[model samples]
Target: MTNVLIGVDLGGTSTKLAFIDENGHFLNKWEIETDKRDSGKYILLNIVNSISEKVKELKIEREQLIGIGIGVPGPVNFETGLVYQCVNLGWGETQVKEILEKETGIPVVVDNDANVAAIGEMWKGAGKGTKNMICVTLGTGIGGGVIMDGNIVHGVKGAGGEIGHIVSVMNDGFTCNCGKKGCLETVASASGISRLAIEAVRKTKRDSKLKEWYEKRNQLTAKDVFDALHEGDQLAEEIVENVTKYLGVALANIGSLLNPEKIVIGGGVSAAGNALLAPLNHYFNQYTFSTVRISTMLVLATLGNDAGVIGGAYLAKTYGDHIRKIKHNSYIKELT
Candidate 1:
């Protein structure tokens, strides 16, 4: 019987299930809307049912499944397979591995979604072959992953890649969800760009198309800023420029600290492409330490939405194989 692996990508709004062979080829996949109205426990049952049905349809046996892996949108204690406080998902302190194991009767592992994405990138995406890499997602808030020598730097409390919370300003500038002032996320994220655009428009009073776009209220988004930039709105241009500058500086600082070979940027804001990358590169050159300035390449993430599933499968294969080997050896000793 061929050994198989199952991976679950548990996001804030949706959950994706993917099955892969030992060699990482896909067998089947599906998605479901996340049920966050109640506790996350509800969705856990949904995941188990879906995976079991798929396995039966595909004629895959219990022994064929080496293990299961999960990627969650929160901090994860990989050693214990626990999810810690996913604010977006509206859950706190859940035992992901235990519940999944009880429901599916398979060994389970879990890790943060962003961290798993980084591992996927390192394994097959933009960071292939390189041992050190950093992955950053520039959405509403900046999300990040750090890898050193093919291992995630999960830190003591699994808060290693909260790069968004890193201090960008010592003085009172802006508040962050982590209860800090002037975090890098405040200046480098999608919401940051929108906030900057709003502030810039108020100061300049520019009679541009941007002002007309949000005529009723101050409701604006990163997409609106990008659209305004495309339309040659001067205020929008200024906001994007500042955003690029600060994000570049933050990347430089991260490079200095980790000395990674590459930094892969993803998420909604990075869709701006060269418009953002050009200015960021300009400032990145100015701020980075000499060694990192020469070594690191800032590239866009290539994996897209598949990163979490792919990385989860990778973990399931590696960690599961180890456990299987240990069990086999122990059984042989007992027999002897």
Candidate 2:
């Protein structure tokens, strides 16, 4: 029987699962809607049932599965597998690892989603071959992970890499979801870029392609801003400049602290490609200390949406041995 790992990425809207081998090769992958009904009480049951069905479909014996690794959309206690909170999933203070293990009879490990994604990138994506790195995901909001000497830094409250909440605008800044103002997320995320673009059009008389695009579409996106910038619209260029400046400065601040070997940018906004990286790199260099700038390379993340599941798989493989040891001890205790 081949040893396999089950990797789960639990999100607000959907849950992605994968079967992977010891060598980090994915055998199969699938997704299911997250049932947040009843405060997400059924989410783990759904995952356990789905894994059982998938194991039967793959003709893999249950014993052949070494363990399960799951990434949750909020802070997690790695040792206890407890999720602190997942506002999107309507979950609060849940014992994920214990419940899943009891239901499925499989050892389980859990971590914060962003941290797992960083692990995935380090194992197979842009950060491959680097031991120290930071991955920043710029989607609706920003998420980040910091890795040093090949291990994730889970701070006292498991919020070590919550880089988005870092204050960027000290005064007169927009309020963030966390209720603070001037966060980097307020100025650099996709939504932030669009918000800035709208404000710019409303306040300035500058002629911009984005202004026309927004007029016709009735809204703007980060992509629209980048498209306009590429078309030589000065206003769009200014918006991009402003957004990247915040991101670059924030990352430079992180660089000063961790001095990681690589800073990888991912998520929806990174699709702007070089249009985003050029100015970001410029500002990153300008703000970062010389030694930090010389050693660290800022790059784009390559794993895309698969990063979470892939990272979960890597976690299962890396931690399976320890999980097995714990299970064996428990069994011996029960026998005694």
Candidate 3:
């Protein structure tokens, strides 16, 4: 029987599941609302039941599912498969791998959500064919993953690629949810960009469209700021410059250290396309090392919402390959 890979991407609002073949094509993809009741105790149960139902509907046998790879929004301890303090999912010290494998009766691989997204982009998205790359997602907050030589760099505690918490601000800065102040997330994230725009509207004396926006809507979004910038709004330009300046410093530090081939930018903010890339690149060139400036390139993520699931499938595929290799070796040794 042909084997299939189950890919799961766990999010705060919904859980995405997909059936992918060994070739990395999606045989089927669907979603289910996440049940966060009881501190997310139902999350995995819901996934397990859904998988059972989907498999029956698709007429796939249980043995066809070689394995499952999942991405979650938290720091994972690879040794124990425990997820720590994932604020979005209301999780604290949960044994993700153990629970999922026990319920599904198949191998399971767990990793930080951002790390999987990076793996997806490298495997099939903008950074395709590149073994060395970094991925940064600019969503409500920032999430990042670093990859080198075709493998994710999971540090001792499996927190290797945390790019958002880099301390970009040394002086007075807004507090981050991580209980740290002056993080790059305070200034470079979508929420952070809007916060900066609001502060400018209140403090700056100059007449600006963003001031009118804040006066009318009583709030602003990163999209609004970028839209105004497209129309040549002076205030939007200054705000974006400040935001990208902080991003530049953080990226430059990372770039100088790893010298990755491509740095992929993904998430909602990347929808601004060249509008965001132009300024970010300008600042990046300024702060980056001379050699890295010419070599490392920045590009927007092409996969969008599918990055996580694709990454999860890749993990399952590789795991299956490893298992087959071991079985082959065992059979050969018995014959000998």
Candidate 4:
């Protein structure tokens, strides 16, 4: 029987799950709405129930199922599977690994969501074949993952690779959810881009597509800014330029520090594609250290929503191999 691994990507609104073989081929992938009721106590129960049903449906025997790798939306102790906090899920110091494994009777591995996404990209997406990489998500908020020598950089407190919280604005800057002011996230995230766009609309005297949209709807999204820039809106161009300056310069600092093989950009904002990449590359080169400028790459993520699940499967594969090695060693000793 082919060994199967369960990969889980836990989120605030929905939990994505997939069944994959040891070789990283996804057999089936699905999602379930995250029940936030009663402090999310039912979340693990729901996951266990789903996995059992899927195993029965696929006729996967207990021995053929190897392990589970779960990525959670919080700072997590990879070794202990303890989640420090998950504001979106109402979780605090949850014992994720112990609970999940006890319910499912399978070996379990847990990691930060962003870290696993980076691993996914390294294993099968943009950073494929590369060991040193950084993955940044530019959605409503910024999330980052750093990998070095083929392993994730989980700091002493499981808060490593928090790139977005880098303070970029020193004076009169916007505040961040982390209770900091002028964070890179305050200027470069999707919401941050929109904030800049709104400021431009209010301050600029020049006529532009953004102003027209603002006058009509009293609002504009980051997508609107990019779309307007494509139509030659000077205001949109300026907003993007400002956004990229914060992003590229921040990345330059990260590059000089780690000199990663590739820095993969993902999330909703990456959908801007070449419009985003061209300007980002220009500023990244302008500020990056010499050797880092030549060596590091900035690329778009390819796996989209599947990155997390694929990454979870990768973790499961590694965990299973380790477990197998221990069992084999024990058997050999018993034989002796």
- Number of backbone collisions per candidate: 0, 0, 0, 0
Per-model TM values vs. the true structure: 0.93, 0.95, 0.97, 0.98
Runs off by more than 4 Å, candidate 1: 216-218, 331-336
Model 2 TM-score (2 dp): 0.95
How does each model score on lDDT?
0.84, 0.91, 0.90, 0.92
lDDT of 1 by residue, 179-289 (tens): 888888887788877777777666666597667776766577888888888888887788787787777788889888888899988877878887777888888889999
Off by over 4 Å in 3: none
Worst 10 residues of 1 by lDDT: 197-206
Pairs with backbone N, CA or C atoms under 3 Å apart (clashes), candidate 4: none
Query: In order, what is each prediction's RMSD in angstroms?
Result: 1.9, 2.6, 1.2, 1.1
Which wins on lDDT, candidate 1 or candidate 2? 2
Worst 10 residues of 4 by lDDT: 84-93
Candidate 4 lDDT over 85-115, as tens digits, reads: 8889988779999999999999999998889
lDDT of 2 by residue, 166-227 (tens): 99888899999999999999989999999999999878786778888888888999899998
Backbone steric clashes in candidate 3, count: 0
Could you tell me which residue pairs clash in candidate 1?
Answer: none
Clashing pairs in 3: none
Better of 3 and 4 by TM-score: 4
